[model samples]
Target: MAGGMPDRNFLVNVFQLVDKDRSGAIDSRELQSALSNGNWMPFNPDTVRLMIGMFDKKGSGTITFEEFGALWKYVTDWQQCFRSFDRDNSGNISKEELKTALTTFGYRFSDKFYDVLMRRFDRSGKGVIYFDDFIQCCIVLHTLTPEFRQLDRDQTGTATFTYEQFLLVLAKILH
Candidate 1:
């Protein structure tokens, strides 16, 4: 495969292995069980569901083999990204590491904002972001940045919105 992606046979084997129920697809639980946080911990269920929602083109709430290839690539790409930022190799991103990662991604946020992010994404309450939580955090930032920019017509890093407009924008993003 190009870009060092696993060959089709390897992917098929992995898909089959993760498809424990032999349902020809992998549900969130199956995916969660198959994934790890680089520390032998199961991936977060919420992240698994979010990923399934993204790749489940059929809207079946599961990932078919046909969809598995893309999902695999997505996870691997995120894995590389997380590892790159996890400089201490602790299998989790500390607040400082997260700050560095976000800054590198071109995000400009206040220390308070970073605190909020750490509190929100640090699911284990350990003041560190695990692999799945890190992915979720990055995805949120990545997805929202352009949407916010679209509203910030002057590029002043801020925008004004009516109550209705705010709801509409949030609705669009949530769906």
Candidate 2:
């Protein structure tokens, strides 16, 4: 709202969500759970079916971890690129809001990005992204982080991965 837009972590969030059993692969119910939980809306059978069609990249009817991962990256990147549109956090991001945010984020103009996002997330087609729409955005943000950036080969940035940018960041864990 204030600045351009803030991109949030999508895929990482979804991975934690859909992997309910912690097994990595998404069974039908798990994907349904993730989709439902992604937004605050009531779960409709038709919505679920449409989501399966959109998010399930493998056409497997169920989602695998890798497939989920891919979907997350695509969605999240789009969201990150245009998050500022949601200035009120009212679960609805308006088009003017989106344009302002993108401007602040350094993208002076991106008609294609706006068009595609509007087509997908704006269910009402009112030029605003709602809660479920935002969730879809987050799903794609999951894979935008690059492995090299994870290492920060330049050593200019922080050593630890904590914030949104660390969505795909690799962390060393101790057993």
Candidate 3:
């Protein structure tokens, strides 16, 4: 509990409150209900599932108390990142803001890529990205970039793969 982080007791209380079913773990629905976006909306189910997948060390599709600390840190870190890039404080990230964030993170993508990203992640069809969607989008990019770099060994901005190889890559990442 250094550096103003919540103490272990506090984390345990929160975990207990969120684990409504008393199953000793927090599932996606429980996590989603417990979390709120910048706009005070419930977290997106997909984002919750993604986080669970990332931290569910037991492969139980749920986060136990032992894993809650890491999950909490992950969400708070993303919240800080979202606030920094959401310059307008509108509780949403515009395409331009997203581009700036990507650039700041050293992602050099084309305009078309940005367009496609916005379209795919704008679940509300509002032409802007809400907190949950923004998290999901960034997580996907963060997870895939290393794999892409590995495939593009020469760094020539391209990779050649057979259909089976491509499927394997996707399967590995998505799993």
Candidate 4:
């Protein structure tokens, strides 16, 4: 578990709440429902599926209590990272702040590249990254960084792909 999450009872309550079928685990349907409810933040089905796949250590097609704990820790860490770079505490991160945060995480993205990222994740059209948007950004960055590097073999920190190559890359990233 991540640091400072000493509230075991609270965690248990949340786990139970999410375990909608009382099956002692959370499946993809339940997890997707919880994430997409727009209660805390919004997550698309694909991202939620990837998240579940990441934490389903037993390969059981569901997450047990122990796995849920790990997921909680992971999300908490993301939240902490977002808060740290959101220096104004305005519940949003500007494009510049996002660029800096990603840079700190070792992603040397160009301004134009970051703009493309913003367009993809910033669905709210508010010109700032909210919690949900930030989560998706982190997911995409963590999951697709290797693929991005492979495509950017020239070390230019940016890659341009043909329509066919773009589809191929998208397929790789989503699955």
Model 1: how far residue 146 lies from native, Å: 2.1
Q: Candidate 3 — which residues are off by over 4 angstroms? A: 1-5, 172-175
Model 3: how far residue 161 lies from native, Å: 1.2
Question: What TM-score number comes out for model 3?
Answer: 0.92
Is candidate 1 or 2 superior in lDDT? 1
Candidates' C-alpha lDDT: 0.87, 0.54, 0.87, 0.77
**Candidate 3 Cα deviation (angstroms), residue 39:** 3.8
- Tell me which of candidates 2 and 3 scores higher on TM-score: 3
RMSD of 4: 3.7
Identify the superior model by TM-score, candidate 1 or candidate 2: 1
Error of model 4, residue 103, in angstroms = 0.8
After superposition, candidate 4 runs with Cα above 4 Å error = 1-10, 32-43, 59-61, 148-169
Candidate 2 per-residue lDDT over residues 13-104, each given as its tens digit: 66677778887666656655554322465543433444555667777776665566555554445444544466776556776675675466
**Which whole-number lDDT from 0 to 100 does residue 37 have in model 2?**
27
Best by TM-score: 3
lDDT of 1 by residue, 1-175 (tens): 1245779999999999999999999999999999988666678777788788889999999999989999999999888888899999988999999999999988888999999999988888889999999988887777677777888999998898788877876664355
Model 3's alpha-carbon lDDT is: 0.87
- Candidates 1 and 4: which is better by TM-score? 1
- Superior by TM-score: candidate 1 or candidate 3: 3
